[model samples]
Target: MSGDDSLRAVFARHRVRLLLAVVLLLLTMLAGVGLLGLSGGFLTAAALAGALGAGTTFNFFSPSAGIRALTFVRIVSRYFEKLVGHDATLRIARDLRVWFFRRALPLAPARLGGTRTGELLARLMSDIGEVDGLLVRAVGPLLALAGIALASIAVAAAIHWPAAVALLLLLLLIGIGVPLLAVHSGDAGEAERARHRTRLRTLAYEGLEGAADLAALDARDAWRARVDGAARQLAGDDHRRRGRLIAGNVLHSACAGLGLLAMLWLALSAFQDGRVTAPLAAALVFLTVALLEVAAGCGLAWQALQSARISAGRLQAIVEQPPSVSDPAHPRPVPASPATLSFEQVVFAWPGESRRVLDGIDLQIRPGERIAIGGDSGCGKTTLSALLLRLWDPQAGAVRWGGVDLREVAQDDWHRHVAWLPQGAPVFAGSIADNLRLGQPQADEARLWAVLEQVRLGDWARRQGGLSAWVGENGATMSAGQARRLAMARALLRDAPLMVLDEPTEGLDVDTAEALLVDMAAALGPRSLLMITHGHLPDGVVHRQYRLQRGRLLEVGGEAQG
Candidate 1:
């Protein structure tokens, strides 16, 4: 869908809430008008009695009672209006966030690869905040203000047509003209605000990531200065935007005051000329003042709308990015027992890179074959593994599993059938059991322990509370070797038909790495293995090896000669 359409759809989702808020606001406004009418009626009766030279002692009591009752009713309606409007806005904000994030997930590690972590964080938090203000604070209040303004003008027209015209002009000035002026003056302020937030977040993230380096270099003062500079820029932007906001408020208030004076003056003249009575004039004046509050809300709401527009634009950019890999409209069902994997003349490159990472590559692994891929660091070994898992689509070829194109299979289905131990495998902050469950959530304690033993981590697991030990944040408490072993155990527990191991023993000691591989190979027994590494192969472990260079695959030793 187009970006405009997507944004419109987002707004449409809140249609029900928007309608409810409008309806409630209208009812509240009408109640306000009814109160105005009641006060006017009591005043009119008192004035008529005085004009006729009759006693008017009871007039004060009647108008006071009506004013008190109306005041109570207005308060209750206003409270409910706020309650429902805010609740609705929060719901819309939640839905938009969920929708944006869900669309973002599949495109990530590819489309999102180039986006900075801090920038993404800012979009997720600050940009989303703008959307909330747009939907709830801006729309609801504007709608309410419009409703009240129209109602007030209509009522005033019945009392005095000229006065009604004056009030309507004031409404236009406060509700529309002043806001437009503010928007014109603050043309790029919202975008600037979003940009500043993104920059600040990026700097903060960099500072945190390089805190150790800065300390080592004794550059703390420089870093602090940088942070302080960003803060000052942010403050400056805020100051300018708020200055415009204050100007808009001042203009709106001035307009409202002029409108109230015109209404009151007209009413007094009508009363003296016998065109209206005293009580009605008093009520009209009070209603005009109350309506001013709604006009003030209108000005604020306009500013919020402008801010939200910028926020939604940022969020929309993320949501509308075409997925690098998307599911087919009609996906083929994956086989229950696939036998082989193949890559046919596959050419791939990282986005924007001149050279193909994997050029015209062709390979096939028969069912249950143990294949090792040996290559230099930049020869695209990990990239090939990622393709096999369909993290990214090859630019000029296809990867097929069990004779079915990988693209044809559902992503979750493909992931389910293949287990992976990535290069620099991630160790999440959690217990061993918690980590293991990621591979197979239903795996029992016995199964978990068995996998740990298979990877030579069973001893470590035993010493560290077995499955229940805390790994600390990002496995910070664990040694590099221990973290690698734990990751291996987690991958092994998957028990899938295919396993792709990417430099799984890169950081291990010789003996530990050797022992772990021996045990892993035995446990993996006939499952198809595609292992990528530069390390020497253990004896009798790998049945075949392929060397990758310049995007070309060449078989080594016995396989090619045969």
Candidate 2:
């Protein structure tokens, strides 16, 4: 499907609200036009009556009452137009953000690994904001003006057909022609501005996040210069687009002036020929003027339209990328009974490379066993864990749980059976209980403490005021060892059958690391374990050890005895 197809679907979801906003906008503009036209006719007729010395016989109450009623309609419609339009815009913004996360999440790490976090944020925030304001900014104004133009032409026709014809020609030229020109000339500028804006946001976000590193490395000035360059480029593009918008407005005004003069000539000619009254001629000119004023906004409306399309396309591009791994068409349920995990004859390599990262790999972890694999950097240690996690399928052979190939079951199902602790596991800002509950949301207070003690953080928790104590953002309130144990407690709390810990003691001292493993080794009842780390483990941490060298697994300890 095309990039905009998803946008069309989202717009369709909120169609009713958008349509109501358009109707309200139309009412406001049309009522304003009608009020002005009626006022013009009443004052003109009143003056004429006075000129003819017949003022006492003229009735002013009906025209004046009509003007008051139209005035009230205009006021009320304008209020609701803003209200309903703003409401729809806000709702669209909320849905677009939710939609972005829903679609972009599934492609994480696999398809979107190459994309920067800041660039993705730019799309989610900046680009989506552009699309989210569509109803109030672009669609409503254009439709309301179109409605006024049509209604004014019809009213003029009822009074004088020739004047109606003149107004119609002018409305077409100014209304359609001006916006079309703005859209045509400003399309490229809008796209460029959006690109530069995204770049600027990305640069600023990255710079702020890495500010300390930038200063420490003495590269702060370089990053700041890049950010400033992006900002200047964005400003230049904005200036150009504004210039185009001004030119379109100028053309619209010229056309509007010519339209008024032509309408005046037709109205006067028809009045002289007795085709219409003097008040009617004046009212037609006033109506034409009002319609032209509304039509003048068409340039901005079309410009907004072009910008929204560009932003929508950018948001859609991220959502449209195909994931490297996907669930099978027919997935078999992962077995609930305890089973063995095995990789048989597995061979794999990184994409776009002929060198194999893993070759002729065969291994098995029986129920209730702990296995440790250590290797030099880039020896496919992490790749082996990733295969078990089923992030990517091996190019050859199969990974199986309970004799069922990993690819045979859904990825989510497999994930439910194994808990993982990545190296740089995040410590979110929340109470100790809150962070613990992330692994198992419904975990009770008792279970929270139990897991905390298992990872040797129970004493730390009590000292800090128990589970309710607030953890600062990114564990700023805690030491590296404390955060690592917190992550370990979270992982240990899961009800999964197998656990994978990638350097669970990362950033911790030897004493703390050994203490954590000693606690975990005793607390682990029957679940299997796979650890990828270079650290020396305390005895009983694992039942077996293997060192992977040059893409081959060599058992260094605990070789199975048949």
TM-score of 1: 0.88
**lDDT minimum window of 10 residues, candidate 1:** 553-562
In candidate 2, stretches whose alpha carbon ends up further than 4 angstroms from where it belongs are 1-5, 55-57, 509-511, 557-562
| Model 2: residue 5 alpha-carbon error in angstroms | 9.8
lDDT tens digits by residue: candidate 2, 226-252: 999999999999889888889999888
Clash count, predicted structure 1: 2
Query: What TM-score, computed on C-alpha atoms, does each candidate reach?
Result: 0.88, 0.94
- Of candidate 2, the 10-residue stretch with the lowest lDDT total is 553-562
Candidate 1: stretches off by over 4 Å: 1-14, 25-54, 57-62, 185-187, 213-222, 336-338, 505-519, 534-541, 555-562
Query: Which is the leading candidate under TM-score?
Result: 2
Model 2, residue 184: distance off in Å is: 1.5
| Candidate 1 lDDT, 214-246, residue by residue in tens | 999999899889888888888888888888888
